[model samples]
Target chain A: MKIKQISIFLQNKKGRLYDVCAVLGKNNINIRALNVAETEAFGVLRIVVNKPDEAVKALGEANFVANITDVVAVEVPDRPGGLAEILKVLADEDVNVEYMYGFVEKATDEALMVFRFDNPDKATEILKKHNIKIASEKEIKEL
Target chain B: MIWNEKFECMPAGELKQLQGERLKKLLPYIYNNCKAYKDKLDKAGIKPDAIRSIDDIKKLPFTTKVDMRDNYPYGLFCTDQKNVVEIHVSSGTTGNPTLVGYTRDDIKLWSEVMARSIACAGAEPSDTIQIAYGYGLFTGGLGFHYGALEMGLRIIPVSAGQTSRQLKIMQDFAPKILGCTPSYALYMAEEAREMGIDPKKGNWKIGIFGAEPWSEQMRTEIEQTWNMLATDVYGLSEIIGPGVAQECPNKIGLHIYSDVFYPEIINPNTGEPVKEGEDGELVITTLTKQAIPFIRYRTRDIVSINHEKCKCGRTSPRISKIRGRTDDMIIVRGINVFPSQIEHVLLGIEGTEPYYQIVVDRQKHQLDEVEVLVEVNSKMFSDEVKQLEHLRAKIKKEIESVLSIGVKVTLVEPKTIERSMGKAKRVIDKRQM
Candidate 1:
């Protein structure tokens, strides 16, 4: 299943992240899972949100560079080596994962991982063939 | 220790007469030989006979770097290519480079002036000189080379860089004169200390520094570091290189060889001659150049000329150290860099906004470092760090290729670079000198 994630461009300046959070909170958009990719000059703030489209619109209106990216979400067992086993499958099949972050599903108390893959459709199909439970956009918003 | 006392010590009234005679011949020579000068003069409605003396030089139209670029390769040469013995090209603002040609006699003139410049720095005929100015089209290294040859001084034509070897040669040969850019002279001093050598203990006696502007504070630093008399030498390729004017041991204003290359200072905005000892744009005319002669060429360098007698007894008019430039051009490590050139490179690259800023800084005991800041737009921004880094590298590569110097490319937030009245301010030079 494909998930929509909102990515905000953050310059390495004071109060940039606080400004992003303030804008999101004012718009009543809830962030589900977040990860920051940082370099010396700037950072990319990527978050899975309850309302991806509305969050991106608010960020754009606030003069922040924001866009929606398609990512694959998979459910993992609440155990050690869960992420490693899933990663091994992708590595064996030569499917590249750009980046990944983890969050816990409150309903089933299961671990869920968000992955940005080079080819999201191929990654989704491979995980489906392997009988792994794929989390959908509905599951993201329900959280 | 004046090199040629006959010309260097000539009385002021006599020098002006010789300058007038040279200018009298130069006007008609360029008028008939070079079409660019002829067209410029014809457009100004001034005939060759209108210039009876050097005093009438104010009547001539001013030539600029843009004019030289428009003429390109050989369009400005007064003599035939067969008589041209050498050529040098300096970087222009954009597109075409400024070209200069030297005839055999012009090369001799360069040598004589350079010899005088070296001697003005207090060099004796028996002393050795280590020339570290770059050679080739730059016109710095060979300019000093010819001068050293003319003076019959032992020369170590090291020709810039190779820091450890430069220190080794300085230790081995013990040259009396060190010729290079002032910044490089300081850089060498630092390198020598790093190699466990005392720069002050070296056998260097005189430092002939030019090709870039330096402050008197820098002069004190260099002199103390090397235990040598550091003097300033000034020149541009358009008029003969590196031997136009030089500061004598007296540390007064640099004495201009106005006998051959007549100097004038004018208001940059009004084009009217400024009063004596007042700062303005420097205008030079090639009075005796055979291959390429210029009439009242606007050098864009700001300075003031002193006509009073120097304590050294050289009657040549002395010009104050260069204060600034009339244009948006800067010299970084002896290379001319215009902001327009950087802007041109940025505009050519897709996804980059036309707005940018150049930051030049010089740390103590180091050469200059340039950092170019380009604002990141939504279209160029990416969620991946690698993609953003790739874009920065691309901008860095394109700019370095255009400027021929390495620079650091920094990506900033949109609107981070300050703006005043809706236009982004371009350059921020933080170097103290």
Candidate 2:
């Protein structure tokens, strides 16, 4: 299953992260899971939000350069080697992982991980073949 | 295509002899008319008769922008106020602007050289020339106008701004030649596309761009965008505007009108002449200016000179496209910017540190953009995102107020910018031009 993720271009300056949150908050859009990837001059603020289209619209209205990206979410056992086992499968299948982030479900012994793969469709097929549980948009939005 | 074959192709020896005679006459004119020159020559214990040959030009004192500013409006004019027909003032960044007066003969000489410059750029009397350089105080507009008129070319003096109107005029008039800064030319191309007109498919065949330093990469971009031959033309108000030198269709270097203007390359720091073909500061002396002829005036522009005959059959010396300015001045979108001006703005703000770097880049749209990377104190860096953005906005506003140029202010971590042992590198120009 594919999840809609928002990637924002932020100059490496003060208040950019807050600005993104303020825009989302004012529009009543909630950020489900977020991560910041940074370089020397700028950073990319990525978020899995409840309403991605709404969040993108709100962020764009606030003058933020935001784009929609497709990512996949998977559920793994909440164990010591949970991520390692899934990563090894993708590596064996020759599917590259650009970046990934995750959060654990509160009531289940399973952790939900989001992945940005080089080939999302192939990665989804490989995970399905390996009987790995793929989380849908409803599951992520509910979280 | 050489406009003045007799003078442009004169033998080196005969040209030097003519220069020597001109210098002999010009020295006496300066010593008698201008008090500042008389005093300087008297203090140096030199007389006008002592200068016998062109080599003796080295013995004369060097004039600078400060000398011109100190004298103000008409102190340096060799002719009487009644004889001076026109005056052009440079847009000085600070204090008083330098004034250049011209008599009727000087205007005729400027038109002659500019006509030659236009010919060098491959424009003929049959082509229609569209001038986009700003008019009034700036020299680019009128200089091209007079020269194109002198060459009997059809003229459309559009001046700068109004992108939509400019494109409409271009499409309607179908002018064959374009004159403006290289950046504006690129900007107009982008606008033309938005207006549903393809610049490459348009009627323009040649573009003469100058008034700012541009790279060969920009030349390629302009050429590819418009599918036309793009050439560089060099000039300054302190000299005789845009006709002092121009790049021929060969695209090698700008041929200096050596008969009217004598060019010398000298070490900016030591003031000693450099070997031919060596890069150094450009010093020019007006050989035929009537109102205010300068003798070995330091142009402050860095370039190398080539004395070899060009493929265009012009024997006059050619100067490489200006590499950069000897001073700290940086040209962004045709506007001069100084790091110290940015520093002044940053120092006034509370959160900013003394350390900052000005990064200049040419965007994909072909216009220049300036970014100021400023280091902030630890407190400011750790502040809430809203506060940090407020600080950036404040700094940008202050800088725009002082420099009159829009800039992107980026707050960097303290000590993030590399420090140097001696002179700090305050500017990073990413534009290849």
Candidate 3:
């Protein structure tokens, strides 16, 4: 299953991250998982949030260049070999992961990992064939 | 399209003779009429009567901005105060401002030259021009205003600012010619898009952009932005407003009306003339100016000149687009660096906004440090960090290679750098000493 992720462009300026957070907070957008990819001059802020379209619209209104990107959220068994098991399944099927970040669900025993894949559709098919549980947009928001 | 065939197409020999005659007459007139020129010529031990031809113009002394400042308002005017019809004052920024007084005849001459400048930019009598240059003491607005009236073009006279109103007028009146500074033209385009109008689809077929030094790369950017034939118009208040020279459709260089305003390029420090096609400071002499005639006035604008005839068949000597101003050239570690040079390189590179600011600082014992801040916009931004880093590194490497100095390139957010409705300020030097 695919989930919508909000990606924002931020220049490496003072308090820019705080400004982005403030915009999201003012709009009552709940962030499920977030990570920043940073460089010397600028940073790309990626967040899995409730109401991705509304978050993007709010950021755009504040003069932020933001857009929605499709990313797969795979459910991992809450065990020592949970990530490795899913990695092996995708590795055997030759599905490449561009980037990934994980977070443990508050009430569930499973961990949720957000992944950007080279070919998302192919990766989604591989996870389905291996009987690995995948999270949907609604599941990501409910987390 | 050729405004005045007799003067514009005069043969080289005849033009030289005309310039020599005008120069011979101008020297005596200024020396006799104005006390400033009298003292300068007497101090240089040159007799005004002995200077017979334009060749002897070198023997005369150069009039610096200090001369204008020392004279202040109305001291260097060659005519009586009663004869002066209007006056324009330039922003001094440092000391006393320089004043230029225009007699009725001088205004007529300005109108004639500006009419030639407008026509040189491929404007016709039927075409309408929306002049965005500021009016009042600034010469740009009224210069184009007087010229368009002379050329019989429908005038909009929307003198600068009011971005939304300017766009609305462009749509409603459908003026074919737009006259303003190049930076303001770009700003207008940005504002036009924000107002839900297509900039390139506008009806501004010709743009006469001047009042500041701009690079050829900037010309291309403006041309692509508005889909207009962007031409450079060159002039100053001291010389005679915005009609000193103009670029023809050939786009090689701006044709200086040498018969009326004689031009010579000289080394800024040595005052010696440079060879043809060599970049140096431009010095102009108002050969026919009545109110305030300048004899070899040092313009301080760096440019090269071409004496050869242009493809447009104008025999007037053409000057290259201003490379930089002597006043604007910042020396970092004994190396000359121009903001325009960095702009030229930046415009050549993809994924860069034209807005940039150069900051220079010096410590007590350390070498001069230079940093260029460029704006990052939506078109230049990416969703990956590595791509943006690559962009920053590319900018630094390209600027360093072009300037031959180590420069720190800082990518700033869009609109961080100050925008201007007139001349865009591009430098910030913080060194105390």
| Top candidate (lDDT) | 1
Model 1, range B1-433, lDDT digits (tens) per residue? 8999988889988988898898888888999998998999999999999988889999999988878888888888888999998998887888666889999999999999999999998999979999999988889999999999999999999998898999999999999999999999999999888889999997879999999999999999999999999999999999998999999999889999988889999999999999999999999998999998888889999999999988998988899999999898989889889898888888888888877999999998898999998988778877778988999999999888777788999888777788989999888999977
Off by over 4 Å in 3: A1-143, B329-433
Task: List the pairs of residues colliding in candidate 1.
Answer: none
The Cα local distance difference test for each model comes to 0.90, 0.84, 0.84
User: How far off is residue A44 in model 3, in Å?
Assistant: 34
User: Model 3 residue B43 lDDT?
Assistant: 93
State the fnat of model 3: 0.41
Candidate 2 is scored at a TM of: 0.68
Q: Write the per-residue lDDT of candidate 2 for residues B232-292, one digit (tens) a residue.
A: 9988888788899999999999999888799999999999999999999999999889899
Q: What is the C-alpha interface RMSD of model 2?
A: 11.5
Candidate 1 yields a Cα-based lDDT of: 0.90
Predicted complex 2: DockQ: 0.02
Error of 3 at B347 (Å): 38
Best of the two (1, 2) by lDDT: 1
Candidate achieving the largest DockQ: 1
Candidate 2 residues lying further than 4 Å off, grouped into runs, are A1-143, B73-75, B80-83, B91-93, B340-357, B372-419, B422-424
Task: Kindly indicate the candidate among 2 and 3 with the higher DockQ.
Answer: 3
What CA RMSD would you report for each candidate?
2.4, 15.2, 17.9
TM-score (chain B) of candidate 2: 0.86
